[model samples]
Target chain A: MKRRNLFIFAVLAALGSGPANAACSFSNEVPIKVLSAAFEAWKSVTDAMAECGNVQASLDQDFRLKQSAAFAANPALYQLGGVANNTIPQLLNEKRIRPLNDLVEKYGQHLKPNQLIKVGGDIVAIAMMVNTQEFAYRKDIFDELGLDVPKTYDQVFEAAEKIRQSGKVDYPLGGMTMSGWNMALEWLNVYASLAGDSFLNADGTPNFNNENGIKALELLKRASEYMDPEYLVSDSTFVQQQMQQGKIAMANIWASRAGAADNEAESKVVGKIYTAASPLAAEDARPVAMLFWDGIVIPRNISDEAAEAAFRVAMEGLDTEMVQAHNDDAVWLIEGYKPGRLAEGAVATASAQPSPISYPMTIEMGLIHSAIGNQISGFFTGAKSAEAALRAAEEEYGTAAREAGLLQ
Target chain B: MRFRTFAAFVAPSLLLMVLFIAAPLTSVFVQSFFVTQPQIQRVETERCTAGFLEQQCTTEIKNVPVLDENGAVVTTTRFVGLDNYRAVVRPDRAFAALSAWDWQALMSIDFWKALRFTLTFTLVTLPLVVGLGLAIALAVNNTMRSIRGPVIFVSLLPFIVTPVIGALSIRWLFVGDGILTRAMEAWSGTEIAMFAQGWTIELLMLFYRVWHVAPFAFVIFYAGLQTMNRETLEAAMVDGASRFERLRYVIVPHLMPLIVFVSLIHLMDAYRVFEEVVGFRSQAHVISLQWLTYDLLQPDDAGNRAVSRASASAMLTMIGIVILLVPLLRKSWRDHKGAR
Candidate 1:
């Protein structure tokens, strides 16, 4: 009887491990490492990739700061890297990431055509999801207040004033206007919607010290009057929490975070929040937001065998199975993803007529973005006028461009 | 001690200092005088990204770094004396603002703004730390022997916490409807937003520094008080000197050296004020010199760092520290000579 018990235990152990291996088509042999931003979608993808075994993933919020240096090392630290539109230029310019055409031909048969990020006719990255900022509001509050969803900047201000008069929420509006990158993106979203020209001149000089820049700044200032007085320190997470806790009625927040609005475990206002396309800066312009896509890239400094194994594991991660499980985590580009209520805003924003532009993917855009982030806060802080702030940003960008050898 | 023994004793630390401190200092100094940049060329490139149902492609001129045959970006390094410094300081703009008596314009410049905050934060907090530390030490000394231990431990709690963690805790206590802010609102019968303006944030930062650093000063002064001249105090008391007079003359004079020592250390530490700015998220309103250098050195998304400008800014910070220390150093030097 004891011998039979031991045999049964051994069989049970083997069976218990069998299903895990069954989930992955192939048991990976080569050790593969990945570095990526820490987010819900990344978590889902990395967890899926780990099923193949021998995968170590480091998910960090500051992954952009570490990617270029890590990939530049000989026998690179990570075999796979997660990149977005704004971050891919550094790796591409330095040739730290490998071209994916050969890899896609070999292993990426299931990838959608739209998921291949192409630069100069070379497939360099594989996109998995698209993200954009969109208008999120409390439907119950709007209904009770007898307010309509705002469509343009003027309408937004009007709605905000009405909400303030009603005292329906702690603050009438919220924003992702934290200093540095978040603030800069907020400014750019409005500027892109208002301006009819490019951000830079043909020779790479800043083109934002014009009338559109002033108008964008003035609109931001006007909007701030209805927002929380401490909006300058509020990031996406802060704004999301404010909405979840019913502290604020509305905000233009990231599509990735819209899922949290209905998460019963954390949100006090579950099922009461609804999303819509971002409000326009003008009546005829596109949504006042920029589109961004997060994707995976293999590094150039790694061996071909490692790169192949990494690509296969990544493909497994981006497969339809993962999307079916995590469809609401992002506006997924995979085949099995079904756009739900949370994804409605992202879809609407993307399909708008005269669609919004993607965030620029160039070296000069990076410099100008940093310059604006550094200088635009002065205007909001009441330390500098809008024109002075714009001029300062231009001067700062000019200095950086000269130092970068992009200008004389 | 024998000369060989002394040399052997100091060799390891000397080697470490040279490797970790002096070498980097020399390299940064050299780098401040030079600029290195990648050779950038503009080229038209077609890029495609995912739209809702299809791929959207755009053709635009992009600035890309020229790469060599080895797949490495080609860089040109040249001697550009004082250019990086000029960029950081912007002496022309600063002078223009100064000549016109435009305080706002001068403060608009990053360096001047950081310098103003750093100096004020250091000088203002110096007296508070010294005074509060002395007060706490005296109070603890006067307490009963059994309860004194717990009092001292409780007083040291803020200092025992990590600097960044302590700053963050204080920020949470006062930031936007935090427990303390809510309480203050109830007490004052008005809404309070502690982080809404620059002066209030500065006030909180100053208060946090004092609260976090006073325990260190207290410990030193307490040790000095233990070695106080008991006979001198007794004589002063016997001569009908008042309690305040005895403290003012005897106890204070006894703690003078410790005060100067604490002040010197505090000045150096406070001038490098970075944690408060980060913890308070005060970059929208105020910044410090060290943060400015760090900001310059931080690479943007394109992996471009202002290395030369950061080095120049770092060197200027060190010079400012040295300048701030001259009077204290001279006084200590005189004291050293008098003792010899």
Candidate 2:
């Protein structure tokens, strides 16, 4: 009788292990097409999904803009696609993506409630990750210099200057000021926090030509002094390289790229980099970091059956098991996500700042973002004054707004 | 052959041309006259009464667009002929700025900025490309036969490269700690950002266009050299005409037709100028007419494309191309008439 009981226990344990191993797998019935950004987190998740069934993912470096055009032109080409938070309003306004409420009710029982992106009472997207620009620094260098983490933009400048004077590094600050979209975003991140409201006024006019705008531009220019001389061409990748190669002491970069600091293959200063919330502009102002969420959406033009299958695959891809396995790949918004070793810095960074604000998603806001990129180069190159740049930005935005039919 | 037989022989080519070229052009022309309106739908909202702890709100679903007659959604394309054209040209704003003598403001407009760059890029690069191509062709033509093959092969490499790839290669050489950039910095003891300002970026773009495109002109000029009259060259030489004089009076006149051909192709190709902007990432400083059209086609925050504006820009670019080519086309027509 004891032998029989032992055999029964063994059989039950084996059966239990089998289900857990194959739990997420489904039949390869329908082919699901996905368009996503070419990032490690997305790659790992998509690789997991591809194990379950038939999936073809087109991962691109510029997937956000490309997917928008793809969905607009031929939505049927993809059953599901990933888009950034700032792009959501436009896709929603165009009615290109379907409400995912029914799919959520059916297959999204495991999805977190906060991850459901609702627009006007309709569930449109299921967010997979939370992305934000956070402040990063060399902890070892800061400790060596007997410095504390900066809490405001002024403090950051002081820290950068101290580091520069110490003769420890060539430039203490690295920037993402590649003109056009990158530079525009920097202006927005600084000014939006200083303005403490929407980019536009209540009456839908351009509103960044005041004191706040000039101050933001001045602060940006001041920060440029301690940065690499080629900061105008510097982008996120350039900043990341600077940190990894120990060329700079601190920068506010996307949290998604923070993992590279600890990557032994790419980093010369491994285990030395730390992260904290982005610096503030003033005592009363908010954090200067820009908040963005990237998630998956199903275009409306595909068949319902296809949509259902695509959602199932995406859900399994974003399931708890996958998140746990690839937790360091991103700051996940899924269940079973505990801050990994690398994310400790990111968590500290986030907690130190004031509550974050979402990047503006209005069409008018997009127009302004582009207009600022076009006009701010003048100021950077000394072809225009701070006030002149602000005026030009406002005028350019006004013209774009009028052309987009957002203004008369 | 009978007229009917001759017509039958030309019918297929004409049909293909009409289907492929004329139809798309016509569609673009018509699309410029119409605009797509965004679809607006009513959404429910809630109002709450103020209270100490929390406001108790009652939800009421209302059809926002349905109730307001003037706010009705536009369901069909509307024809606003010439509106898109006006937006592309911005004539009123330009005129006002010009009246005020605000030259800066007038050039600040997107259309004017793009047009200025496009025109400058095309007109400035035209002569350099022609001169360089003719020079290379003359050099290769007079070379020893044994070395001619290798020289020709090596010279055609630049032209053989894809345009975007060539531009990117050149950009990488001079951008941010790149080999050439570092070398220059080391030598000059000063930093250089080649893509920083408008003039520098424009100069780099001009250099890249000449480098990448001169080889095509070289091959054409070289091939034209093979068919030149050796007897005329001998006569010019016997008359004690120098090599430069021989080239100026004999070879150039002979290569004029090919020069015209290459210039026409280059003008049309360079006037559009899309790939260089993309490869160099110069949209912050330099933009072309074709790039403006592409920028318009990009969907805005509403996911709605500016189709009418793109169409209008495209039409304007085509008009610019036609204007630039008018002299050459007229010369060709006159030459053909003289030949008859």
Candidate 3:
């Protein structure tokens, strides 16, 4: 009887383990056509949701399905992971991309995972990096500033100053100066312009204490005169909306972010508004931009076949009709800047122009961008002198990178 | 056999406490001390521009491996004795030394100034949340049968709402841009910084704290209040006692232990207020203890372990809490013992 009980137990143990393995072994090789349909569904949901950035965030099952399939097919080809404000973890995890490097070498003919992620992190589409577009003010603010649409940062600033000096508005400039994050981006534009190419070295070391960096600080300090003291802590999007309503003169904001800022129904300044370059302290530097992104990543445990199938499904999802429509309407401003839009309406039309720019992890650029923002916040707040703040910022950031084990 | 039974009974609880609670706590604390590899250090030095190299245009930025006072590599947050406590005592060694971003916070002497106000808030608010909770509990206990469910739930609304949203609702209601703001400006002719002024923050805290806390406190007190004998209250009333005298002689005595329990719990929760203030803070930085603790843990460019500093602050906070609460605990306990 005891021997029979032991045998029964052995059989039960084997059966108990089957369910977990069954989930992992599930097939992800849905055809391109099915994937195209999925892409449309995803795009529709995304447009309707409007606010959510990742499906995994709001819609778990779909994100999981997309992630699992991508992992099953080619785990290395997809996946981007990082913490908010925890860039160090992202950099450290870059070592995990080595298999991906080998995969890119083998599949150089198809797509670049990094560049595709730049546009959007959906399954079917190859994410594009360069996403920007222009917006305009409504009629009322346009007439009040006596400002015609300006093309350059110089023209915009002049218009802003004219509007401010005219005493028509309460707030002169409406832009974020809070959390040292938005302010950090503004600082990056200034540094990238003033410090020229020297602020960044080939391997990603910054030239922050350099004269160009100081010049960038000085420029930010000058802009501080127009900023409200509370600007340092206001929500970035909310501030931009106030600007759209002609509450402030001008705000240099994200292209994807312009939807919330545009007051189509009630905005007096809607048609008169124009998007301009976030200019530089030095004339040579162009407007700086980067892709705010998310991507599907496969956990390392899946089989080779499953991984490849998942990658295919994920890419197909990105390319689908609904997903692209959602991206075009909600996430991507398709006119001035096009991401993965092949189709003009939503899905990328077959004849659409290929996107320019790169995505995923850019370790070197990240190092440069991080330093500029914090340093600039300090400059505007007058926490320290421009020279001293830049100098200290240089030391702190360089050491921080080295200590986080990113820089050798 | 008895010893074995006792051991068996205690072992599971002890093991669980160690495994689930103590183990994770110890691990997080230990992690604060150790810096593992795969961490990158950001660029700390920049080149001098042109002729500026003549003076201090360049100095080799220090990335000296973090060291202990003895100049040994200190990797973990050990019990560094009173060194942490001394940080509070020594103005130079306070949080001001570690964060330059916070350097702008030091211009006003209010960095340290908030402590006096915070203590006053603690002294006032803790009792109010408990006192009001008990009063509501007593009222609910004596309520007509028809309104009991509604009364209990209506009192509990503040606790269920997420504090962030609750604070937000309060802010929209009271803010300068909202209707109340315009009315206040028109009638009172005064500008108010809700987050900057200590009183405004205290009022916001009292409003929200009472809201989130009253329900739980009421439930606890309500359960305790249910056991209150009608015979004792009737005897007091028949003895020619007035309402105030009846409450003082009968009800206050019954509710003393409940008050102590609620105060202890609320005091601990109040010390960790973070999310609400970050959501607000418009003009002035009203630096709180939790905010300072977050600064230590926030990943820096160096990615170095802030374990020692975090551990030290935690230890000091624990001590401060104990010191503040000792008198109240003793007084309450004494009252309990004397009543028994």
Candidate 4:
């Protein structure tokens, strides 16, 4: 009787393993490695890819810092990399990523037309999702205070004032104001909304040191007054937690985090949060946001066989089946993705009159972004005036640009 | 010992020091004087990215690195003497701010700001660590033997924890609505935010460094206390010396060498304060020289890092540590010569 029972258990274990292999249409033979950002969408995609076997995915928040150097190795450390608009330039400029036109033509029958990221008329990356910062707020509190959904910065400030007076939450506003990359992105969003597509001159020198720059700085300072006093340490996750815990009433948070509001396990105020298009900095300008896309790229240093295998596995990961299972994970560009209610803010912002600009994929923009991140905190800390902070950022950008050989 | 034995004993460690420490230091010193940059060219290119419902294409002139025939970025290494250092120190801006009597402007510069905090953090915590450590050693010395072990264990717990983890633990204890902060708020009947300002964060960092390191000082001082000359202490006692008088005249004099040793170690460690800035996430409010170097080395989104500037900052940090140790080294040298 015991031997029969053991034999039956072994049979059951074999049955359990059968479907795991059957889920992927093809059995992968190559040992492929992928490096990507650690996020919900990447997790879903990579897990789907793992079904094909021999795929090792490293999900790290610091993937950008490693991607370029890893891809530049004689035999690339990773066969595939996940990148966004801002992170793809270094790989492109170094000629480290291969053009995927032939691979796409062979195996990308299911890929959408808009999914191909082309530079110099050659497909380089296959975008999976679109992301942007949008206006997220606690709808319950807004209705309780009889406040309308804010469309412009002034209306947002007025609504924030009303919420503050009502004593409904700990703070009337939350922001990704942590003093490095987050703060720099916040500055760019506001600056671009006020002065569109003028980040640099034709010669790659900074061009945001005039009236629009000061106004953007002043607006950020104003917004900080309605936020928590510890705003300088508040990153996206912190602000997301603040919203989920019902501590903050409103924030211009990432669209990727909107699903967390309804996560019953962690959120205290489930279904109480809502999102809308990002508020405009001016009447006629676009929303105060920038569009970003997360995608996969094949590395040039890998052998053609590895690249082909990696691309096929990537396609399997990004198939309609994955999107159907993880529809709300991101604003997926895949065909089967059904944009849920949480995607409304991102969709509305993207389709608005005078839609927001995609983040620049240029070498000079990277230096400028770092310079702004390093120096802009002084304006809010009361250490420097807005003009002085802008001047300092320009000077910092100049130094870095010169070092990078973008400036003489 | 025979000369051959001495050579065998010393050779391995000396070789390791040269291979690990001296080689890297020389590389960094050389790197600080030179700049390696990719050759860049301006080009007009059309790029397309995914939009929500469609694709957005734009044409712009971008600065892109020139790639060689073999698909590697072409780079040029040049000896740019003092340029990286000048970029970091910015003497022109510093002198301008100084001459104008603009303290805020001077502090806005990264190097000067980091230096001010690093110096204060090092100097302020040194005496406190020594004092607290000495006090604990004296208390532990007078305690009953049975309780001494547990007391010492409890005191050494903070030191046993990893430095970054210890800082993070303290941060959680006080960060936003943490239990300690909530209790303090209840006690004071007012709201408090510990990380809302620069000085409060600096104060917390100093407190944490003292708390974490005083146990190390305590263990060393406790060891020194066991070898204390009982006769000298008894002589002071019979001479009608009060407890304070004995401690001042006999006990402190005997512990002076140990104090200097701990001071030298603490100064070297404290001058490179980095974990607290990261664990506390106080980059916006305050920064240290070590953190500044790390920041320069960290790659941005576009994979750009100021490697030469980072090396320069590292060299400056080492120079600072050497200057701080000069006085202590001089005293130790004098004492050694006198003994000889």
How would you order the candidates by DockQ, starting with the best? 4, 1, 2, 3
Over the stretch B125-204, how does candidate 2's per-residue lDDT look in tens digits? 99999999999998898899999999999998998899999889988998866899989999999988787667888999
**TM-score versus the correct structure, for each prediction:** 0.96, 0.87, 0.64, 0.96
Range of the 10 consecutive residues with the lowest summed lDDT in candidate 1 chain A = A12-21
Q: Candidate 2: where is the Cα deviation over 4 Å?
A: A1-30, A61-79, A94-110, A299-309, A340-353, A361-363, A386-405, B39-76, B96-103
Q: Give the TM-score of candidate 2.
A: 0.87
Error of 2 at A251 (Å): 1.4
Per-residue lDDT over B1-340 for candidate 3, one digit per residue giving the tens place of the 0 to 100 score:
7999999999999999999989876765654444444323333442221110010123323232343454233342233345433432345534574465564344322234335434655677787787788788878988898989988888888888888788778777665355766677679887644543445655776676667777888988998878888999899888999988987888877877777788788787776665556555522334455555554455433233334445545555556678777877898879879979
**Highest-DockQ candidate:** 4
Query: What is the C-alpha lDDT profile of model 4 across B161-195, one tens digit per residue?
Result: 99999999989999887899999999999998999
Candidate 1: where is the Cα deviation over 4 Å? Answer: A1-19
Provide C-alpha RMSD values for all models, in order.
3.7, 7.0, 11.3, 3.5
Residue range A1-408, candidate 4, lDDT tens digits: 667545533543442333334468897878788999999999888878877766778899889988888998989999989999999998999888999999999999878889999998999999999999889988889898889999999999999999999999999999999998899999999999988889887677887689989989899999999999989989999998998889999999899998999899999988888889999998998899999999999999989999999999999989999899899899999988887877788889988889998998888778888899999998888888898899999999998888888888
Per-model DockQ against the true two-chain complex:
0.80, 0.19, 0.09, 0.84
- Which residue pairs clash in candidate 4? none
The worst-scoring run of ten residues by lDDT in candidate 2 chain B lies at: B47-56
How would the docking of model 2 be graded?
A: incorrect
lDDT of each: 0.90, 0.78, 0.48, 0.91
Question: TM-score for model 4?
Answer: 0.96
DockQ-wise, the better of 1 and 3 is: 1
